[model samples]
Target: MRDIPVVLSGYKLTVVEPPAPNTRDDGNGGQVVVTDRQGVTQFVVALFAKLRVGPGERAPKGEEIKVTLLTDPGLGFEEDSRVELVDPRINAYQIDSPDGRSISGISFKAMGLKPVRAPREEK
Candidate 1:
């Protein structure tokens, strides 16, 4: 199975859920970080974001969608922080299921996130 390309955004991007440290196992006794071909490790952050349905799709506003972000070191986002994802895409991986079945799992990845700039307070 493959991950369907998903572009999730919103006018009011609130966090309904939060992200946790996502880890993986290696063949060795020790665990490993999820990195790219360049060996750059990416931190995983998962959360449910309240967003409106993007163009080309018919959906209601304020639709909540689960978004996963894989970022480089020193990148972290907070709950209810308004932000935008750059070039976000989905990654689908085939995993072994408990019922002896192969299944496709989905996660989201992006170049990074930029905080939506708030209006400058008139001092």
Candidate 2:
């Protein structure tokens, strides 16, 4: 993880798709604990999306930042909901292909992404 975690301030998740099994397709995916109750099929869902960034403290010009977010049980995110990622972790990963080639980039994962509460006015 990076020393200074990346934060997407004033972000709006336009599309939050359903979670899928971390099949290690990337060759560097993390572990996901899967537990069951009454065959309900519960597992930690890995969510990813391309979000529209709002102009805020971090982002002044406002640009789009695609985020690969992971959350437990998944989340029902409505379109254009103002949200923020809490304690996001970014790690660099390198993958070696079978043809003597490699690819490297940073992978992002947030502890949680929730709706941003309205700022309260000072008395």
Candidate 3:
């Protein structure tokens, strides 16, 4: 299925883990780096997403998701830093096993990520 675009305006994203190279195991017991169609290295960034709550609303709920980036998100994005996903999209996938088991879920991908600066207080 085609990826669905996601708008995150109502949610806050925080980096739970720093960026890391996305790789797969090669047959020779080595790891092969994963890249996009354009040959740009892909990276995985773990983020914690929390829904914004209004007055009298229930407690905020959040979930952690690892996003695949087509290219590096650059510096300044570190663990515990607030961030925003650039051009985020969600794709649904399912894998069937020979043991009659199956796994299905959504995956997240993004063009990049940027740090979200906090608003400055006024005097």
Candidate 4:
């Protein structure tokens, strides 16, 4: 079994259509420019959410980012599960477990897409 570690940030989520599974060619065909929150436009894929992490400090790798999808707290969540990157900029997302339970966790590092830019204006 392959072990993948991850970090999480607290943020709510709303599901969006999933991306194509192995379609990594960013320049596959005619692309379109899309507007972002920072007032800048760029050619990009439609965004979506996959998980939700609660408020607080980020979790360290190997640490489980607790999530409570149900009204009850007795049912908890695990880390490193398959989560969706709902918002590319913030890395916000949500996901459903194998048992059909829903939970959200920050994709602060979705597939390790780190070194992410700081939206220019902030710089």
Candidate 5:
């Protein structure tokens, strides 16, 4: 699992549906934030995101949604963390955690926009 930096610098956090590519203007998917964790930032990807929901209804509606960058374990999530939902084009989603430490499962079929990574700096 590569470490990808998930940054939330100047992006808005919302649970709206992600904009369609041919619908309107190009929407900003999710942002990448790089923490102090080693080999953790490389797992960041705009195509996928993590959301934390409540445990009341099987399919909760009108519930609060938080979006956060996530890592890929190829099977499930690596940890139980809180995430925020940006962009209005995104529908609803769930996070799958198997090892509870490396990656989470996301239904990317409903997602439209993905975070675009900035160019790396040259030494």
Candidate 6:
């Protein structure tokens, strides 16, 4: 897997879904929370991102991305709130299934996320 660094400065990110525990099916009809290599629980946060563009430029495109976090995002990340990802990165993966089908795509991950604060009006 190749890890790629992501630059988010050109995009505006809005929370679509709050942070939730990432889980996987435990073999025996049970769900288990996923954790990172450091034993920190992983969380998934869905965000809607729109590219910032100047006037007359191509219409800013938008996409929804789910980011995996190695730690809890604490508080203040309510739905629809503007946020920024901390230490965001992407990984490319390819898995070949037994049926000769290939699955491949990029996955997003981050250390955490924080709510974006509005700038105060200067006096």
Residues 82-110 of candidate 4 have per-residue lDDT tens digits of: 33332233335578899999897453222
TM-score of 5: 0.18
Candidate 4 is scored at a TM of: 0.19
**What's the lDDT for residue 50 in model 6?**
93
Q: Pull out the clashing pairs in model 3.
A: none
- Candidate 2 vs candidate 5: the TM-score winner is 2
Local accuracy of candidate 6 as per-residue lDDT tens digits, 12-39: 8999999999999999999999987878
Q: List the RMSD of every prediction in angstroms.
A: 5.8, 7.5, 1.7, 17.1, 19.1, 2.2
Any runs in candidate 3 off by more than 4 Å, and if so which? none
Model 3 Cα displacement at 63 (Å)? 0.5
Q: lDDT of each structure? A: 0.60, 0.51, 0.90, 0.31, 0.32, 0.90
User: What does the lDDT read for residue 32 in candidate 2?
Assistant: 45
Quote each prediction's TM-score. Answer: 0.57, 0.49, 0.90, 0.19, 0.18, 0.87
The candidate 1 region of ten consecutive residues with least summed lDDT is 67-76
Give the lDDT of residue 95 in candidate 6. Answer: 100
Q: List the residue pairs that clash in candidate 1.
A: none
By the lDDT metric, which is better: model 1 or model 4? 1
Which of the two, 1 or 3, has more TM-score? 3
RMSD to the native, candidate 6? 2.2
Give lDDT tens digits, candidate 5, residues 12-117: 2233433212122335765444432564432222222333344562432333333333333232222332223233322334455676655434222211223334
Count clashes in each candidate, considering only residues at least 3 apart in sequence or on different chains: 0, 0, 0, 12, 41, 0
lDDT digits (tens) for residues 2-115 of candidate 1: 445556644555445444444578888878766666766665544446545566976454545555456542444577766666667777778887999998766667665666
| Candidate 2 residue lDDT tens string, 1-123 | 463486655344333444343333344576543333443333222333344545563433434444444445256544455556667667788999999999998766565566666569899
Kindly report the root-mean-square deviation of model 3 from the true structure over all alpha carbons: 1.7
